[model samples]
Target: MKARLPFIFIIITMMLNSIGIGLILPVMPSLITELTGGSISSAALWGGVLATTYAVMQFFMGPTLGNLSDRYGRRPILLISLVAMGLDYILLSLAGTIWWLFAGRVIAGITGATFSTASAYIADISAPEKRAANFGLIGAAFGVGFIIGPAIGGFLGEIGPRVPFMAAAVVALGNATLGYFVLPETLPQSKRRTFDWTRANPLGALMSIRKIPNLTGLVVVFLIFTISHQVYPSVWSYYTIERFDFTPKMIGASLGAFGFFMAIIQGGVIRMIIPKLGEMRTAMWGMGLNFVVFILVAFLGEVWMLFALMPLMTLGAIAGPALQGIMSKLVDDDAQGELQGIFASVTGIALILSPITMTSIFKYFTDSDAPYYLPGAPFLASSLLEISAMALLFVIAKRIWGTAATPAQ
Candidate 1:
C-alpha cells in the first residue's frame, strides 16, 4: 500500500482533471445560449469557436509544457496546471461576455496540456515491461471521470448554467490542494535536461520523433488510428438518433456503458493480455477487431445490436496502451514527455480534421437530395482507414522484425 501511493495519487489527479473538462460539456451550449440572448444557432457557432480555441492552444502549448516538466520537475508543473485549470473555471463562471468565455477556454487549454507531463510521470516510476498496464490505468481513470462528471454536471445545470462551472472549480482546486501535499517529483535532477525552445513547438517536436530510430512508421500508424477512431465520437449520436430515434437519455446511457466497459478493459484486461500476447500482436489484434466492428456498426439495422456489439468494441482499447508502451520503450527516459507531447499534438490535429471529415461525410450521405443516401457511409470510410492503418502496421512490423515478428516471441 505504501509503494502504491504515488500511482494512486497520479490516477486521482488525472481523474480530477478529466472531470473538470467533463463538467463543462453538459452546460456549455446552454450557457452560450443565455449569454447570446437565446439564439441557439449563434450559440452553437460560438461554441465551436470556443472549442477550436481550446484545441488550437493545446496543440501549440502541449510540447512546451511537457518540456518544462522535464526541466523543472513534474510535481511543480502538474500542481501549477491544476491550480490554473481551477482558476480558469472560476473565470468562466464569472464571465458576462463572449470574449471573457473565450479567454477562459484559452486558459483552460494551456493548463489542460498537462497529460503529456502526467504520462512522463508515470513512465518515470514504471519499468519498461509494466508501462503498458500503467498507461492503461490512466485510460481507466479518464473513463471513470467521464462516467461521473457529466451526470453530476447535468444535474447541477438544472439549478443554473454557471452552477457546474463553480462546482468544477471547487473540485479542481481541492484536487490541486491534495496534489500539492501528496504528489512527489518523479523526474530527478540527474535525469533532467535543459529545455530547448526549438524542439518545444509542435513541428519541432514531431521532427524529434523522426530522429528516433524505427519509430517513424509506428508514429504514422498511431496518428492514422487516432484519426479514424474519432468517427465514433463525431457521428455516434447523430447516427443513432437518425436511425433508431434514440432519445437523449438513451444516448447518455449508451455513452455511460461505453465508458464503463472501456474502464474495465483498460484497468483489468490489458494487464493480463499484454504479457501473453505481446504488445505488437495485441495491437494488431485490436486494430483488426476495430476494423470489423466499425463495419458492423455502419450497417446494423437494430438498436439492440449496438448494445450487443459494444463488448467486442471494447477490445480495441488495447491498441492505445500497447502502442504507447512500444513508443515509451523506444525513447529514452528524458524524452518521454516530449514524445507524449508530440502525440498529443497529433491528437489535436486529428481532432481538428476528423470532425469536419466525418460530419461532412455523414451530412452528404444523409441528405435528402444526395446522389445516394447511406447513413453508414462515414463508418465505411472509417473502416477503410483502419484497414489502411493495419496494413501499415503489418508492413512496419515485418520490415523491423522479419517473419518472426507476428507472434513477437
Candidate 2:
C-alpha cells in the first residue's frame, strides 16, 4: 500500500473530478428548464454551452499544463488543479442561473488538465516495465469514477440536483486536501525541465512532434482512433433516450457501463495480457474488437444486448496503454513532458472534431419521426473509422515498432 500510494492518490483524484462532472449532467436539463420558464431547447443549448466551454479551455491549456508539470513537477500542478476543480464544483453547486453553471464549467475545463499532470506523474514513477500497468490503473480510475459517480448523482438528484452538486464539491475539496498532504512528487529536481511558455503552447506541442522521427504517422493514427471512439459519448445518451425511453438513471448507468468495461479491461486484463500478447498486437486486437463490437451495437437495439455488448467495449481500453507505451518508446527521456503534452493536445483536437462530425452524420440519417430513429448509424460510421484506424496502426507497428513490439523489457 505504501509503494502504491502515488497511483492510489492519482486514481482517487481522478475519481473525485469525474464524480463532480457526473453529478451535474443527468439532472441539469430539468434544473435549467425550470429556471428558464420551461424551454426544452434552451436547456439543451445551455448543456452544449457548458460542454463547449470545457472543450475550448481544454483545447488551449492541455499542452501548457503538461509542459508546466514537466518543469515544475507533477505534485504542484496536481494540487493546484485539484483546488481549482474543487472551486469548480462549489461554483456549480451555488449557481442560480445558466450562466453561472457555464462559468463553473469553464473553470473546470481550465483546471481539468489534472489528467495530464497525473499522466506525467505516472510517467515519472513508472519503470519501463511497469508503465503500461500503471497507466491502466489511470483508465481504471476513470471507469470506477464514472460508474459510481452517476449512480450517486442519480440517487442524490432525487433529493434535489443541488444536493449532488454540493456533495461533489465537498468530495473534491476532500480529495484535494488528501492529494496535497499525501501524494509524493514523482519527478525529482534534477530531471525537471525548464518551462517555456512559447514552446508550451498547443502549436508548440505540434511543432515538437515534427522534430521526432516517425511520430507524425503515429499521431495521425491516434487521432483517427480517437475520432472513431467518440461515438460512445457524442450520441449514446440521445440514442438510449430515443430507443428505450431511458430515464436519467438508466442513461447514467448506460454511460457508466462503458466505463465499467474499460475499468475491468485496463485495470485487470491489460496488465496480464500485455506481458503475453505484447503491446502492439494487444493494441491491434483491441482495435479490431472495438470495430466489431461497435458494429454489433448498431444492430442490436435491445436493452439486454447493450448489457452483453459492454464487455466488447473493453477492446478499446487495451489500445490506450498499448499506444501510450509505443509513444513512450518513440520519445527519449528528456522529451517525455513535451511528448505527453502532444499526445494530450492531439486527443483534445480529436475530441473537438469527433463530436461535431459524428453528430452531424447522426442528425443527417435520423431526422425523422420513424419508430427507431435509425439510432445505430453513428455506431456503424464509428466502426468504419475504427477499421481504417486499426489498419493504419498495424502499418505503423509493422514498420516502426514491428509486430510483437513489447514495451522495453
Candidate 3:
C-alpha cells in the first residue's frame, strides 16, 4: 500500500479534478432555482453565468499556479488546491442564495490547479519514453470520473440539490487527506526554476511557450484540435434532440458510452499502440481517425449509425496524450509545469470560444428562418478545423518532433 500510494493519490486527484465540475452539473439548476426563487429559465441563465465565471477564472490562473508549482514545488500547490476546492464545495453546499453560489464558484475557479499540477507531477516522475502512456492514464482517470460524477449527482439531486455539493466536498477533502499522507514532492530543489510573474497569464504563457523552438506550431495544432473537439460538448445534445428526437436519458446513455470508450482507449489501447508505432505515428493516426469520424458524424444519416460509430469515435483519444508526450519530451525538465499550463490555458480559451462559435453555427442552421437546415453543421466545422490541425502537424512534424529534436532512444 505504501509503495503505490503516490500513484494512488494521483489517480484520486485526477478523478476529483474531472469530477468537480460534472458532479455539480446535474444539480445546479435545482440549486439555483431554490436560491434565486426564480423560474427554471432564469436559474439556467444564472447557471451559465456561474459556469463562465469558473472558466474565466481558471483561464487566468492556470499559468500562475503552474509557475508557482515550478518555483515552490508541486506538493504544496496541489494540497492547498485540493483543500480550497473542498472548502468551496462546502460553500456551495451551504450557499443560501444566488450570490453565495457565485462566490463559491469564484473561489472554486481561482483555486482549481489540480489538473495542471498533477500533469507536472506525472511528468516529473515519468521517463521520456513513458510520458505519453502515463499521460493517457490521466485521460482514463478523468473519463471514468466524469462518467461516475453525473450519475451520482443526478441520484443525489433527487434527495436534495445541495447533497451533491456535500458529496463533492467529501470526495475532495478525502483526496486531500490521502495526498497529504502519501504524496511526495516530485519537483526537487535543484530542479526548481524561478517563477516569473511576467509569463503568468494566457498571452504571456503563450509567449513563454513560443520561446521553445519546436513547440509553438504544435501549440497551434493543439489549440485547433481542442477547439474542434468542443463540438461534442457544445452542440451534441441540441443536435441529437433536434435531428433524432433523442430524450435526456438517451443523451446521457450516449455520452456515458463515449466516456467509457475513451477510458478504454486512453488507458489500455494507447499504451499498446504507442510502444509499437511511436508517439509521432500514434498522434497522426489518432488525429486522422478523428477527422474521418468528425466528417462521418457531420453527414450521419441514421441514429443507429452514431451509436455504431461510438467505438471508432473514441479512438481519437490517442492523439491528445501522444501530442502531450511529444511536447513533454521536447521541453526541458524544469518547464513541464509551464508546458502543462500552456495546454490548460489553451483549453480554457477553447472552452470560452468554441461553445459560442459552434452553438452559433448550430443555431443558424437549425433556426426556422435560416437559409438552409443542417443540424450537424457544427460537426462539419469541427471536421474542417481538425483537418487544418492535421495539415499543420504534418507540415511541422519533422521540424518539431523529428529524430534530431526527439533524440535517439
Better of 2 and 3 by TM-score: 2
lDDT of 1 by residue, 338-392 (tens): 8876777677887766766776777667666668767778888988988898899
Model 2, span 1-409: residue lDDT tens: 8888877888788777787777766666556665666343334445545565687788878767988988988888888888878777778778887778778878888898677778778877789899878886777667677888877776777677677778887887788888877898888899888888886576567878889998898888788788788777666655665567666677667667767777777667888977787767777887888888888888776899888778877667687677777777889999997887787778888777776566555554555543445667878988898789788877776687565454442
Which segments of candidate 1 are over 4 A away from where they belong?
Answer: 1-10, 26-52, 67-80, 90-103, 116-139, 154-163, 177-196, 212-214, 235-251, 274-281, 300-303, 323-345, 362-377, 398-409
The Cα RMSD in angstroms, rounded to one decimal, for candidate 2 relative to the true structure is 4.8
Local distance difference test scores for all models: 0.79, 0.74, 0.77
Error of 1 at 82 (Å): 3.1
Most accurate candidate by lDDT: 1
Ranking by lDDT: 1, 3, 2
**Clashing pairs in model 2, backbone N/Cα/C closer than 3 A:** none
Per-residue lDDT of candidate 3, residues 1-409 (tens digit): 7766787788778888777666776667567768988644344346556766777778778768888999999999999999999999999899998999999988998887556678888888888898888887887788888877766665666678788889899999998898898999989899999999875757655668867877888888888888888777666656776678654445546666667777777668888988777777777777888888988998888989998998887888687877788788889999997797688778888877776677677767766676888877888898888889888877887665454223222
Q: How does residue 276 of candidate 2 score in lDDT?
A: 82
